[model samples]
Target: MPHDIISGDRHPEALPLAEKVREEERARIARDLHDELGAHLTGIKMALGLLRESLARAQGPEQPLEQARYAEQLIDEAGDAMHGIIDDLCPPIVEFGLAEALQWQSRMFTRQTGIVCRQRCGDGLDELGEFEVITLFRIVREALSNVAKYAHAENALITVERQGDVLTLRIEDDGRGFDLASAARNGSGLGNMRRRAQALQGTLQLDTVQGKGTTITVVAPVAR
Candidate 1:
C-alpha cells in the first residue's frame, strides 16, 4: 500500500519545488506576453491602421480593391500571429483543460489557415497530469506549426488515446511531404518536436513520403 501510494505520487520528491517552478515559469510567460508579444502585435495593428487610413483616403476602384485586399491580409496575418504568440506563451490548454482548449485551437487554426483540423481524444485523457497535458500540448503545437508552415495541408487529424500505462497522440496531415534526411540535416521543426517529446520521457516519430503527407506520433507513460 505504501509503495502503491509512492508510485502514484509523481512529484513526491519535489512537489513544493515543482509547484514553485510552475509559478515562476507562468510569470515568465506572462511577462513575455506583456512585453514582447504585445508590443509587436500592437505595432502591427498600428501599421495596419495607418495603411487602412491611406487606403480609405485613396480614390480608385481597381487599386483600392487591391489595397484593401492587401490590408485585409495584413490584418489577418497580424491577428493570427498575435493569437499564436499568446497560445504559445500560455497554452490555452493550461486553464481550460485538454478538450476545450484543443477544440478552440483547432477552430482557430482552421479559421486562420483555411486548413481543416479534426481532433479526437479518449476519455482517459482527462486523467492525465498537468505535465502530461503540457507535453501533449507542445506536441500538438509543433505539429500544427509544421502544418501551417510546411504541410500545405487542406486537412489534418489529431487523436489522443490511452492504452494501459501508455498514452499516445497522433497528428496526421495530407500535404506535400519531404525527405526526412534532408529535413533533419537542415534541422526542421520535427527535431524540435522530438526534443519536446524526449523532455517528457516520450518519443515522437515522423512518418512521411514525398508528395504524400505526414503523420507525427508521440507516446509517453501515463502517470498513475
Candidate 2:
C-alpha cells in the first residue's frame, strides 16, 4: 500500500486536512500563474501588435509584419492555454458556484474530446460550504477526465441530486468498461477519487461491466 493510504487509514481525521492543504497550494499556484505568466503573455501580445502596426506604417518588409502577426496569434493561444490550466488548478466555484462550474466543465469536455456530455442538477445544493463545493467539483472533473482519456465513450452524463440532507453525485458513460481489479492495480485516478470522497466523509461507488459502461456515484451528507 502507498504510504499516504496507510497514513490516511491510520488517521482518518487527517485526510480532510491534507486535502485542504493540497487545495490551498493549487490555488496559490494558479494565482501566481495568472498574475505573473499571464501578465507577461499579455504584454508580449501587445508588443507584437505594436510591432505589426509600426511595420505596416513604415511600409517595411512584409516578412517582419507577417512574423509579428504570427507571434501575436501564438501569444493568444498561449493565453488561452494558461487560462485552462488555471481553471483546472482552481476552478471558478467561488465565482460561479458548483452548478455552473459543472455545466461549463461538461461543455468543455465535449468540445475538447468530441464526446457528448450533459449535466442535470437538482435543487437544494445552493447551501454547500466552499470546501464541499470545490471537492465535489474536482471529483466530477476527474471522473469526466477519465472518461475522456480511457472510457472511449460517445456520451456522458453528470447528475447531481439532493434528497433530504443527503447529496448524490453520479457520472455515467456509455463506453467500454474495464475490469475493476485491473484498474485498481494500474491506475491512481480511482484512488484519487476515493480519497477526495473520504475527505468529504462521503462514499464512492463504481459500477461497471466489460463492454457495457461505467457509472461512478458519490453520496455524502449535506448537513455539514
Candidate 3:
C-alpha cells in the first residue's frame, strides 16, 4: 500500500493546486465573455443605430419611429449591462497597473458622488506582482464603495506606500463613523475586507469614532 494513501494528513500541495486550477478556469471564462458577448453587443448596437437612421431618412410613420427609438434605447441599455458584466468578470485594474488604476477609480468616484477623493503613491511599487496589486486595488475599491454608501463623506483619501519589507494601503474618509462591533455583527462587508487582507498574509486595521470618521489600513509583505 502506498504511504500517500490512508494518511491522516492531506497532501500539503493539494489546496494550492486546486486554487491554481480554479484561477485558470476563471480567466478562461472571463476572456470568452469579453470577446464573444462584447462583440455581439457591439453588433446589436450598430444594427439598431443603422435601423434608426434609415427609418428617420424614410420619414416613417409615427408608430414605427417611436418603436425604432424604443428599440435603440433597449440596445443601448443592453450594451451598458454587458460592459458592467465584463467589468465584474475581469476589470482592467491589473492591466492598467496599480497607480493608474487607483487614479482612475478615484476620479470616477469623485465624478459620481461629488466626493473629493484623492490618491497618493510612493516609490518602488513596480516590483509588486499583479496579484498583490489587484488585491490591494480591490480592497481600496471596497472601502470606497462602503464610504459612498454609508459614510455620507465629503472628502476621502487613499495612500499607498512601501515601507521596508512591507507595503501599506490606507483609506480615510471624513464621514459619520459606525460602531465596529455593531457593523461586524450586522453586516459582512467589513468581515469580507478582513478576509481579503488575510488572504494576502496581511493585517487590516479599522479606526473610527462616532461623528468623527473612518480609516482602514492594510499592511502586507511585498511579493518580490
Give the best candidate by TM-score. Answer: 2
Better of 1 and 3 by lDDT: 3
TM-scores for all predictions = 0.65, 0.82, 0.81
- Give the per-residue lDDT of model 1 (tens digit) for 1-112: 0010001123444443554466459757767776787787677767767766776677556676576668668767876776676666667566666766677778888998
Q: Give the TM-score ranking, best first.
A: 2, 3, 1
Ranking by lDDT: 2, 3, 1
Query: Where is the poorest 10-residue window by lDDT in model 1?
Result: 1-10
TM-score of 2: 0.82
Q: Residue 173 in model 1: shift from native, Å?
A: 0.5
Q: After superposition, how far is residue 41 of candidate 2 from its true place, in Å?
A: 2.1
**Candidates' lDDT values, in order?**
0.72, 0.85, 0.77
Score residue 42 of candidate 1 by CA lDDT. Answer: 74
lDDT value for candidate 2? 0.85
List ranges where model 1 is wrong by over 4 Å: 1-27, 31-86
Best by lDDT: 2
